[model samples]
Target: MQKAHTSFALALSLFLAVSCTNNKDAEQIAPSLSAEASQSSKDGILTSELSKPIGMSIDQKNQIWVSQSGTGKNDGSVVVVTPNGRVQTAFTGFGSQVLPNNELGGLGHVLYQDGMLYVLDGLNGRLYIIDVSSYKAKDAPVPASSLNFIAIKPFVLSQNLSNPLDSNLYDLTFGPDGRLYIADAGANAIISVNLATKALSVFARIPNATPTIQAVPTGIIYDGSKFLVSTLTGFPFVTGLAKVLQISTSGVVSDYRSGFTALTNLAPAKGDDLLVTEYARFVFSPPVVGWQPSTGRVANAAGTTVLGGLNEITDIERINPNFYYVLSTAEGTIQKLKY
Candidate 1:
């Protein structure tokens, strides 16, 4: 029954990806993507080219690994691009096959650790761990393409919860405490799973807010003592209520910042500061458009800031002591922000 539902959801997403462009007008329907930095803060840098970048993580080599959930079929793939904007290698989705009129390779999120690249399959509730050292998908008993892959291996994590409904884990990162914190967007909760033991626990469940569907959770990070989670109000109007919540190790969640909408991914930098990627532009959805300047922290904020001009910020990472690099999925370009 769950597999059937997942198939339907994937089909719908693929449909949206195809007609995403203005079919009647035959024009790509991206955000207005204004190249103007006029309305942006001095901190906002403008650029395009990040290619629908959704998930990101820094490898041991410090290069940025990006996953492109393209706008349509033939657009999805995994890219290993250097900090200097050079494409190293590209891996196409499972096979070259694209479902008839369906989008392919919607590779959503990625994690690079312990010489392995773990990709969370958004189309299905499955995890694909690639051996970074081998550059090949790991040798799972189910051949790496089967939807029934989970039962084939003992690498599965165990959670105490009796109910196992699909939550569609999105952005994930290791907390300061070394536990894996996953944005269980389907359930709007930040899930903490012990990496060493795979014991799972619900760290926090997002409280209901305006435009109920926008309650979808996205990015997450930990800064020594607290965990920060990003929210994208998945509604049809301008609620402008997306926020980042600060959760303690004990699992107490609080609204650390509010008023902004559709912030997707996040990363931590120096001096108690964090970087966020915004994904507010949608045509079949919202009307807001254009390249707003790459907005992020110039200096560590005492609290989160509710501002604008950030394109679909999908990922971030601290390159050096006070310098951070941000990836804009909408623009396909990276910004180097100096704090």
Candidate 2:
């Protein structure tokens, strides 16, 4: 996902000419026994078969769903990985493209709720809905052409905004009011969708991280009372400039926390804290014009690092109180962190 910074910028420039874009449980064990169990259960690498995975979500049955922005050949897909590391392709053949920077662009973040999977396509600007209630681990892969989706670009372009021509529906979360709130990285705003009516509205426009750079809002989550959104600041991708914005249920946005770099996703932590993914720092030198490897990390809302040395980290999912699954697009692997 760090590669997206340059790729998306290139795409946005072209548009000026011609338009486009948890879990838990158990209480009987002693403190010592539980601590040992937690330590032993942290399987660092869940699976290494993913090809440029950009998003992830855990289901009711503890299955991890990942969206892969395939090798830019219209082969994008979503796969299901069991807790034991078993992987199965659930859907395939979505639109994908190889950006000018050689980065894969297409599939974005995914969400699973009540047996339904919400897949976001950043390249095409569409939200796909797939019914996976009966999709067992043994079920065969399904073709994306067979499913249904809602084209968000049309609705987003219809709204009056500073940048209405572009719409990249990057990440989404269901609010307390049951509306799907999406972080539009391209449009630099939060969009709300009425699931029942399929209506779209601009909830809030993200302010610029700096006077010259746009705030590319990426990951988002609703914490019962409000929405928390993360930003991957534009251009030079300056360090310690990205922030996590807090939005009221009614769409008022404000700075919740600052002093982070290239934030990609957010998750609820114990109490009022949050677990965020720092994708990576940008290297603008000619020899290394991309994300600096091993600079990504998992940090708390206070900007304290929980885990570091991550390469191109894209998303983070909290499975239980003691563990988190962190996705590294560069490594094409998920590392289970014991918190």
Candidate 3:
């Protein structure tokens, strides 16, 4: 184990963006663990292979909060990491173990605004709100009551949806008008939840996707006027079909740009453009875990490479005008990069 603020350039594997398995017969991308294959940092960058880090956000105090979707039910947790790299537990032990098989909720993306922390429970199909105003930083679990979780339906594992994949909640963001938008890969729809009234409804769906394939939405970001979403079409995510769409506030959805393979996460970049990351590369074979060898790269709005040769870059967080923090899922560490 390494301490905070240590710099070591690593080229880690960036795994899949959305972490839900819908079809039992579907191929699972569960790659074998290897620090040798993973912890290959270089060029003097700070790295720490935190466990299952997915969603991230910088709070008002500049503290980094990462929601880690642990490998099992009842294992999901969140950690508050400083920009300098020191890590501490924000909360833990919140999900319940379901009956029959002990299936538990998996924590995915997290958003922080004002004094509230919003966490998307990807596995359990619920959302959680945590107020960190009085909580002190420590690497220990807090009271489960303090977690403030809302149980959505069982959206994963044993979800009994009309469409099996409809239960996959991949990403979430808060709009300027004070509403939370969610990206559901299983249903390929964007759902919104009103925090004040606890009202949930379908915001939009794939209005122009190929009916033969599943155009699942993975990542979503509110960019002033509209919400930009990244969609993954079909089981083995194809390049041409992995395009970003712009959804209006009234729920009108349309394509914005293309030329990505298994696009997973999206973020607002400098001046009217966006930063998108690919979960995997254009592999000709069926999707396997960690098959793309540093095939992932970060691109600008015009499909130009900003950071090339990445290993499954899952999420990108802009710290300032010219600096960003990229989450390399396969490497299990967050690396700093300048654009």
Candidate 4:
């Protein structure tokens, strides 16, 4: 069963490689933005000292917290970046492993709510909780040894399912009921956790994109009423197949939108508008090594491109009506945009 789990992980790793190229080439892919949308756009804040940053969240203090999946050596960490770009490590020494395809997996996503920081360990199904209410931007790093974690894999394995050998606790969001809903990429399902009891349950099983392609759930968000999930469709990634799913608070899953390729994350925009990350379009043919450079994009619910030419964009955070931050894993930088 463990071997089966590793195989599933290796397949997902093929699509999670972070590019090391600069964003200068990415700007050329899509040179045009809407006149109103292009009012002011500039890469903001932290650019250096990032290692395969995957997940990001903003707190009440307006502090930006980012998770780095490290160089696949158990060096994964979560850092707090102040509004002025001062970076400080908050937690260190999480599990980081290099997959068979050379992709790194470790800290998956970070969520800050109230006074606690919820972190997901992708390589090993676990959730680490830290009290960051009193943590300042200049405070020293918090070692993982002092934090408490909840083992999620054992609970996932206990549930009888068709494909239950593996569990990759990826992106997560707080549901209306105050439970933590996690997108398990390996199991292809949403797992809900009761914070009060630390109990786990399979909330909903995501259907495959096609007859053979699994809808690997990547990022999730709660929009007051329902939960929205983004998927990175399985191997041999077909263009225009990836989509966002709508899951009810009661656990019913249905399609919300389609015609996307390699969707990664979603964020609420002005009014009912939604911003989604199109991670990247992969290149499988000869002479093309991996994903097409700068093909990644930030699009709306209607499939309209808002920002294009991004490289491996994994997360998007909206700060206010006109301000936003985008995390480009490949570029290892946070891009601030005003619309």
Q: What is the number of backbone collisions in each predicted candidate, taken in the order shown?
A: 20, 0, 12, 0
Q: Please report how far candidate 2 places residue 73 from its true position, in Å.
A: 1.2
Worst 10 residues of 3 by lDDT: 2-11
Give the per-residue lDDT digits (tens) of candidate 3, residues 1-339.
Answer: 110000000111123332331000001111232334234334524458478677787665556678776655577778887545667877776453332323333665787766677777665677888787665666466644466665554423233332433365667887666778878765567777788887677788764345555666777887778888886565445556678998998999888998776676777766787788876564555565434667778888888988888876667776556556677666667776667
The models' CA-based lDDT, in order, is 0.51, 0.76, 0.62, 0.75
Off by over 4 Å in 1: 1-50, 70-76, 94-105, 134-166, 196-199, 211-214, 237-239, 281-310
Q: What TM-score do all the candidates reach, one by one?
A: 0.66, 0.87, 0.79, 0.87
Candidate 1 is scored at a TM of: 0.66
Query: Across residues 1-339, which tens digit of lDDT does each residue of candidate 1 receive?
Result: 122113222322422344350000001111221233223313444234456666665555554567766554444556675434445444554322244545343555677765666565554444555666644223222223432222201212243221234455566766767666667655566676675665667777666455234356677766667777776655432345667788888888888876654566666654455556555433343342322234432212343443345544556655455445566654666665655
How does model 4 fare in lDDT? 0.75
Candidate 2's TM-score reads: 0.87
Which 10 consecutive residues of model 4 have the lowest summed lDDT?
Answer: 21-30
| Alpha-carbon RMSD, each predicted model | 10.3, 5.8, 10.5, 6.6
TM-score, predicted candidate 3 vs. hidden true structure? 0.79
Number of the candidate with higher TM-score, 1 or 3: 3
Superposition error at 50 for model 4 (Å): 1.8
Off by over 4 Å in 4: 1-48, 162-164
Model 2 scores a C-alpha lDDT of: 0.76
Rank the candidate models, highest lDDT first.
2, 4, 3, 1
Backbone clashes (count) for model 2: 0
